[model samples]
Target: SMGNQILGGGGFGTRLMSEVREKRGLSYGVYSGFTPMQARGPFMINLQTRAEMSEGTLKLVQDVLADYLKTGPTEKELDDAKRELSGSFPLSTASNADIVGQLGAIGFYNLPLSHLEDFMQQSQNLTVEQVRAALNKHLSTDKMVIVSAGPTVPQKPLPAPTDKPAEQPLGV
Candidate 1:
């Protein structure tokens, strides 16, 4: 989940946002998520771009994902993800509805009474290698399903991912 956050978990600083939208302007938005349920759940990456840019955008997203899987998140990314998750933890119980939802999920999922705090502590203690290994264990670009809904139009190829040394994600 931490790896997902660093890669594409619906934030302005995520890799997908930084690469696919902010850097190259291929799509207005791009995000990925992992939904862990009591049973099977889905991991999804979604984006929307102009019809003509569909194929190119897909390729770009795939390439970015592939590269991310190969290299994993950087130290800075890991720190940022941890910080973000920790900062948001308190909100999970700030409202009655939120607290009820959390409690319900704990009961429904057969989680421990201290599941929330346990999960938060575990998340905070996770090493970068552990996060990367967990992500790699479950995700593969080749196994992903690509679903697009829009007109099919010819378009120029999108630029490939690059090795720019600056802080910002570039190209793809």
Candidate 2:
């Protein structure tokens, strides 16, 4: 599940996190996500690290995205991402404050009132083909905008993971 992969608005993990943090010690935290809106919201990636690592970190992140675009997510990866989204749906809105927050977003977006009720079912139904098709259709690496802010020090390329054994998550 993503609980181990990437840290986004949620800490569900992905390939980006695996490469940027788990493999290389480029940054302390890194995440990327998309918010589909009436038009197109944003495909944003966020990272935090010491000022000196910024240049290398940014370059590495781009490399990650390029690799992903070259080969979209595998079936297992898609399943894991969807599973995390569906399984955590309830816990995500377990609190009253969370409920209100969700409701506010729904209302502001003019989404159906039944959105939450059907979220899990919809998420679980997503197929790898669908995810891949969507990515191929919407994302183009050549056109992506890169924004970097931090130190300008020359940094070395990150080292590859030595023994990326499957990690055992310790807590929720």
Candidate 3:
């Protein structure tokens, strides 16, 4: 879910991007992350829009978060998130720098030596219910902390797009 917020499915495109940007014209970007920790770490979601749209964008963000928390994730969403992680995982291990970082975390945190292996194994086996449950348990909107800085503007409806799509591009 966090990954979807950040990079979308496999980073090809994202739901949040679609909802907040493409559909609603709210913000340029929004992102989230889930990092390993000895106990619990952070799950963050963030975005930015025009000064006038900040409040509306924030509301939309809260709405999105509320929907996510309430319903958890659909099976397709769950599968997509897992696929994205697994497909890109090789990059996380593709370099000595990456290996060193992985090892450093394991050592620094006193994590099991098989942490990497265990992580892959566990991730592959997680069900949609499990992912949804885990995220709901930890990533609650009730517990979220929001801080915003922007100019205040009277709320207004998004300007309807009046331009029609071109039949073909100039080059094409």
Over 31-64, each residue of candidate 1 has an lDDT whose tens digit, in order, gives 8998888886889998878776678788788988
Position 124, candidate 2: lDDT: 75
Instruction: Show model 2 residue runs off by greater than 4 Å.
Output: 1-12, 35-38, 50-53, 164-172
- Please write out the lDDT profile of model 3 over residues 1-172, one tens digit for every residue: 3334333333225656656666555555576666667788876666777766667667777777677667766777766667777887778889999999989988989989999888867877777667667767887777888888767777665534222323211211
Encode model 2's per-residue lDDT on 19-119: one tens digit a residue. 76666655556777776577877777888765656676677777777766666677777677776676777887999999999999898889899998877
| Model 3 Cα shift for residue 36 (angstroms) | 5.4
What's the lDDT for all of these models?
A: 0.82, 0.65, 0.65
Candidate 2 matches the true fold with a TM-score of: 0.75
Global lDDT for candidate 1?
0.82
Full ranking by lDDT: 1, 3, 2
Candidate 3 local accuracy as lDDT? 0.65
Among all windows of ten consecutive residues in candidate 1, which has the lowest summed lDDT?
163-172
Ranking by TM-score: 1, 3, 2
Candidate 1 similarity to native, TM-score: 0.88
